[model samples]
Target: MPPLHILHIDASARPGRSGVDTRGSHTRRLTHRFADRWQAARPQDTLTYRDVGRQPPSPVSGEWIAAAFTRPERRDEAARAHLAESDVLVDELLRADLIVIGAPMYNFGLPAQLKAWVDNVVRVGVTFGFDRSRPGEPYWPMLPPDKRLVILSSRGDYGYDPGGRLESVNLVERGLTVPMGYLGLTQTHSIAIEYDEFADERLRASISAAEAAVDDLVGKLARDFAEAAKPSLAVA
Candidate 1:
């Protein structure tokens, strides 16, 4: 099978890995471990890392919106400048078969940086297409359906999963998956570490379980991609 290209994005404000740094990010730890496991299992697979936590894309502005709405051919230098970073981001997203995002929940939602990254990538005429002619379905995804998105998150409280205590309020996964799905990345998987504020046995256990989940997810995805790549045999 051909080697897959993975885009790894870290969105935690906290730097370094947990247990390595006294006050490190659990999301970072999970994402780093996932990447390491992927490399160990498939050394030939390529990875592109983007640290939006530290170097975030600029927030969307009026000029940026106007530029994005403008036709590519008609865009002037100023318009291009407004969308240069977004273009690079969209290119990265297009090249990646698997996207891993380490999103530590901030105020029960996404971090400002990750939000900005999402805004930059979900551009008109790039990730999604819009048309007034097709009133029934004017918008369509531009990305292929095969792309997969894995969101590794960390939260201070527990019970964020489906039917959990805080399922409705948990916006990290919903916020990310919705936009990603709109871009044709409907294959979304998420794993999170809870009880961060407590920092007790629950926190430790959550971390361990989340790490194990990451390992399992990586192995499963690797096998799935490999199997899908195998050529089908003709029947006589």
Candidate 2:
């Protein structure tokens, strides 16, 4: 459609891009390349980048929970203050047409910081709706159905893809997918570099492959979204 608004999030604790730093984060490299490629293709599009690894949002606490459950209009000053950060995060998510997340697997799961980010965005009466009377469907996704999600991830070991040896234990992508899907961002795609700990030819190959995949993904998504946004012609 019009210029796309992309939200780029980096959740790696490491400071530098891969290949540049000996111990850099692979996810960062992919995300940067993705953003660069996207901008080169569609110069008019806008990007909002958030580095949650270094500056994570506040974790969900008792006060945050209390404030979230409280009705917005009924909330007092304290309640509003508790949810202020969450409010900003939710607003950013709502504005994005495409969300790109750089998440590296930490101990078979998401990093603590990224999880905290997730907790903040999945707000009540904001990204989702809840009702006590509706027994069959008490919860509903609040975001529009067309929002797209891209998770560029890295892992210490290999075989984490679907049907792979370590798929069951690989919770990085699944963890994000469940929460994001709950918010109606089901158009998801993921590409990850594996064998990170090995730091050998395998890791190098994986990174190269992942970069190519990211480029392909960016091109495909940019074209697909543009096509989908075009108006259809009426038949005579």
Candidate 3:
């Protein structure tokens, strides 16, 4: 079997330590460890990393939008070049068998950098298309059917269950996952590490717990991969 291509995206601006305007460092740590485990399990697999923090693009502009929406054949040289960058990003996503996104909660939502990445990739009639074919199914997802996604999220406060004081209205996970599901990526999992209540000792414990969870998940994924490689027999 061929190696699985994994696209790893880290959106946290902070390179290390958690502080105001930067809290997703833990998410990056956890995802790096997870990626390590995944590569160890499948040595032939390839991982591509994209850091949106240091290289955020300017907001999409009218010219970019026009270029993006225009048909390839109709686009001029400069317009095609502009759209090509976005096309490359989307193509990378389309080529990957798995996607891993590291996001930290910002103002109870996704960091602006990550949102910009989404805007660049989720083009109309590409990732998704509007179809009035059925009365209810207005939008149809055009993404590949075989891709899986894993999200590593970190929050300052804990809110595992819904409707708690620290329960964030940010809804970044929901926003990403629902769209991924809409895009036909049904195999999605998220691991969150919360640290709002952690002191020195408690913070260490939180990190330990998060590491263990990643280890356990890695083992399960490896086992599943091995099982899937086995040939199935049909009754005569």
Candidate 4:
């Protein structure tokens, strides 16, 4: 296999324009850390970045719906025009071996910009197939289940982890996993910096924990890709 292709998506509204702003955005920091770590380990590995927060892909419209459902050869020029951006988004997703999303929890859920990206990529008859004739499991993923999804997130509140006090209300992971699952991304991992609103000792501690997790996850992924990219020993 060639060097691993990584797609990095940043969904936080913060642009990291200023020194202070960049320092404050935990998601941005974690994403940078992961990208740098990967590149250091394997310079050949590719990284394609999309900042949805700043330049969000257009939301799906009625025309998009019609265009998506229509058969490719049958689609008119108007339909083709409607799905142009969506096609690009889906293609980017299909080309990646690893995907890293930097998400900041907004109101206990995913940011609208990130949601738009999800809506664009998880298309019918493209990323997923719907078979009405099937007795059960009508919707099946069409993409290969080989992608690794890493989510670097930050939350203003705590207890979002499984069995945590506020786990029931935490929708960030579910929001991402459900839609991405439709596109066959089952190898998922999340590292969240919680207690943002707290902005105190607890917040610092959360950031520390998340930073450690990022180091561990990126180290493992880099190692795997490096090993995979190595040439096998030639037989005599």
Residues 26-119 of candidate 3: C-alpha lDDT, one tens digit per residue: 8778788889998888889898998886676456778889987887789899887777668877888888888888887887788898888877
Most TM-score-accurate candidate: 1
How do all models score by TM-score?
0.98, 0.97, 0.86, 0.92
Pick by TM-score: 3 or 4, better one: 4
- Name the regions of candidate 3 deviating beyond 4 angstroms: 17-24, 132-136, 160-165, 168-170, 196-198, 226-236
lDDT (Cα, tens digit) per residue for candidate 4, span 1-236:
57778899999888882124644567888898888888887788788999999999999999999999999999999999999999998998999999999988898899999999999998999999997998888998888766889998888889899999999988888999988887688889999988888879998888888888998998887667667668899999
Ranking by lDDT: 1, 2, 4, 3
Q: Which candidate order results from sorting by TM-score in descending order? A: 1, 2, 4, 3
Select the stronger candidate by lDDT from 2 and 3. Answer: 2
* lDDT of candidate model 1 versus the reference: 0.95
For model 2, which pairs clash? Answer: none
Alpha-carbon runs more than 4 Å astray in model 4: 17-23, 226-236
Q: What would the per-residue lDDT of candidate 2 be over residues 1-236, giving only the tens digit for each residue? A: 69999999999999889888877889999999999999999999999999998899989999999989988889999999999999988889999999999999999999999999999999878898988898899999999778899999999999999999999999999899999999889999999999988989999899999999999999999989999999999999
lDDT of 4 at 172: 87
Clashing pairs in 1: none
Who is ahead in lDDT, 1 or 2?
Answer: 1
